[model samples]
Target: METQAAETVERVQPHLAESLPVPVRVGKGVRRLALRVALVVEAAGGGVAAHIADLVRELRVRGGVEIHLVIPVGVRFDGVIIGDDVLAQCDTVHRLPMLRAVGRADTIAFARLFRCLHKISPDIVHSHSSKAGALARLCFGPWKQVYTPHAVYTLNPYLSRGQRRFYGLVEGVLGRFRSDRIIAVSVDEAEHLQRVLRIPAARIETIFNGVKKQPLLTAAEARSALGLPHDAVVIGFVGRLDFQKGVDRLVRVAQNILDRGLGNVIFAVMGPGDFTVASGVSADATPNNVRVLGALSQARTYFSAFDIFSLPSRYEGFPYVLLEAMAANVPIVSTRVSGAAELITAEHVGVVVPNEDDVTIFADTIAVLAQEPLTRERMSRNCERAIESFSATTMIERTVNLYNRLLKEHR
Candidate 1:
């Protein structure tokens, strides 16, 4: 792996902005220098992993950018898996211990990460998610730093006043001095950064994460593979079975539907992480109508089987799963979380419940979709057209452009 990675690094060309529509500016003329980028991430799963993978793949194709990955050692939580192809594209790979919570172990991880960054000495250090974002900022070096908070912790409505203040202070301090640029995946998230965290408007950039439009299994085929009955209406969910994702709320919504005896609907939940533990609803007690299908590779392939795709997240920075649902032409029934409202219109794409945790409203929204097949079909048609704007090409181009602008200023 080491030799292969070195060979990959050796093949990097010296045409950083050659493929980009606009070239990087250095003084008066265009400067063509190979930009070395080191990506630091701790929550290397779900949307975070998917974003990094897409970004790395696009950067590799564009050429002239030496990419390095700094990730934690061990498997990801929530059955989240990063493809091997993402790692193969990198010039070097560094694995160190990184805990989700701030702990004594972080001191050791910090030292190791500092050494790794010192060795790479990348032109830009791009950190994904909160943990990596916080760590990369504190270990200040000559490299310019860009932090993508996937979703800020302080956005959690359930957070206590004291907890909100504490996390806000940390984010403010980091955003003010440590980070060169803060990338928010949604405009709603950018507003939260300015309003809640009090980060300067100049420091934040809104970049909607994009997804590739891929062929997926047909409804019949997808249902057959998943052992779901074609006769039943499936309200499918794809995400980590955790508090942030509101997996427990999803379970409750499913129960509410069952209790009300609304249609022949069954909820199909798929993702990594223990459903019983995360949802606080034991496996034995799980309703027969709710099928916990653990996790699957390329889960989006089965989105066709879903009559309605549900996102019950309490907070999010533009979820990639919603993008996948849109790509699949699956009508969404999402809670009005950070990016949910932006992605989903109340009746155009799918219903967006105003309340995040209200089980009745959520269940009612799902029931409405199930009962009105024409509404679902119309929304599905809308999804086909709406998804085109959120293309992978546009996203990749914008990111590279951001890198170019940041590097030009650094020079």
Candidate 2:
């Protein structure tokens, strides 16, 4: 069956190749209206970088904006590069020697940022992640600025009550000065901004993250490269190993699966984080059944090897990994936090357990899916259908429209 699946994917690869460079057309007038824009992001990695890179590429190719990217100096990560192909569309790339520091360093960063903003005189300044958003807004003065939190700092369960409240207060205060609009990656996140952070519902907009679906590689080829049997049931997790990712819970879930003696199952984690940082650390860590492939440059290769995908994040603004997994037509299992629940439906997609649920529930859900081949196939098909709503073109068009509207209103 696995061999046949591989053959099917291989046969379809040529059709996928023929569809290269998904066409995007922008009206000449709208292109002409494209304002001078600056995008700010903190240290790059993971989904945030991918999202920004995709938007930049699409904007440069389809829109008329004179785009400038302001990124931290000395930071390198997979998919961080905008590439010459995309860079050709941009007006400039500016590197700031701003360290990802707190206190005095942040003050210095703000100073530098203010100077840069003064020099660039951008029509719009869009910021991503916490540090960049805060600093960008602080330095904006009277300039139009927009922020996307990616997942607000206040959402982390690891923080103390005081810390959460302090962060929330800071965001509320900053909300008054720096933000013209708050872009929430999910509807759930938008609601939180309105209820908890007191951002006006009118000012908040939900824009779902978009992913480009790569041509499917054969499952046999994928498994063989990863050195797994053709018949193995593969469950894959992709994300950073930090506390927010809920990797500790994932381990417990994997252990439960092993304890239940499931046959020929393979578990793989693809991302970076120290195992020691995770709670519930044990001497008997990383059992034989589990493989930790830390931080692959291209997840599509590993994604192809999976029969199912899971993301047990404690909170998220919106996870691009989940979108990528869905695009790959893999069944999903994730916590009902952030946008994960909203993205997956019980009828069409995989299970969404409560955030605090024990690993047993997650493991048992995987067990059921593994045992039922027909159910897995149905879920996979549904994932393919769900992905239609989240193409890169949709994200670019909506974002560009927002940019134009905001620029017009300000003008």
Candidate 3:
């Protein structure tokens, strides 16, 4: 029997690599059995989607791993339907009706998924996010199951204590009885699962999310792209609008930063939210000093224009946005959300605040970073030094190795 050699993968000319799919390697003479991976993800946008996209890219080129994407039927990423361009490289795509967040616990749907996976008989079923994590653990048949929680639902400050306890109970049951293995995106997240869910230390591993590096655009060019005034000091944020991201608090604190009258300091936001005029946090919440991009496919490309990249997330897993900032050598100010502390440990890299909801504190931190040019330059240098630690290539290689290990164990 013969198989394709992924090492001979035809490259997508450097310029077209981002939007277009690179051609997969397959030919008449092409002797390796691809490890079959059935990857399930309910949320098809934001950081987790970026992670999936990167994994898909590397797996297609690296060979020896046949990927089958099991994504939400009606979900979209970058404001477009998950189309054939996304499907262009995958071995298969399963668009099943599944909801993200809320831990979508519908047994009927789970049974249908189980039957589907049973037929495909993937070597391993790797699920992302809390909702998919809950469903994948139950969809177990012959496949080894691997779950990654972008953020643990039980530890989210936005949820009520009672709700947190319920989630904790559910996670405990899943870990004790159903889960095969778990992979946390950060060391903090891995530790939390071990401590809170009592998942054994050996059962979980931390693999940091990573970003692709590119020649950074000049500040002027990046500012032009985002419509920010080049002369102004800008603080940027990129994330989907949701409870976990704490966009509401972001707007308020950004307003406070302006109130302090720090001359020429502006807040630039890339990414959309549900905050319309109908929602209490409407367009008006964006003071004159703030610019909302709604959504931009290449928003992170504008990172160089920012004096500081701020992430006021109440809770998170490993965010691709933070890695993007690191790649751009942008200084950071983030809530000590799950994976943040690990990356923002050094003062030069930026500061991580303990209080998730303390908008004043978050605001104060950003203002200083925005105003201090020498400090920002030093942090930028530090980010350049640390970029290799968050390389997308590294993330993909480790993931492929894990898939192979699971296959060997299964045999």
* Poorest 10 consecutive residues by lDDT, candidate 2: 4-13
Q: 177-210, model 2: which lDDT tens digit per residue?
A: 4688888898888888888888777677788899
For every candidate in turn, the CA RMSD to the true structure comes to 4.9, 9.4, 6.2
- Residues 154-209 of candidate 3 have per-residue lDDT tens digits of 76767788887888888878876777778888887888899987888777878888
* Per-prediction TM-score to the true structure, in the order listed: 0.90, 0.87, 0.87
Please report the candidate that would top TM-score against the real structure.
Answer: 1
What is the Å distance of residue 391 in model 2 from its true position? 1.4
C-alpha lDDT score of every prediction, in listed order? 0.84, 0.75, 0.75
Model 2 spans > 4 angstroms off: 1-33, 75-89, 99-101, 279-284
Model 2: per-residue Cα lDDT at residue 333: 88
Q: Each candidate: how many clashes?
A: 3, 0, 2
Among these predictions, the greatest lDDT belongs to 1
> Per-residue CA lDDT of candidate 1, range 33-82, in tens?
47888899998889888888878888878878878888876574222345
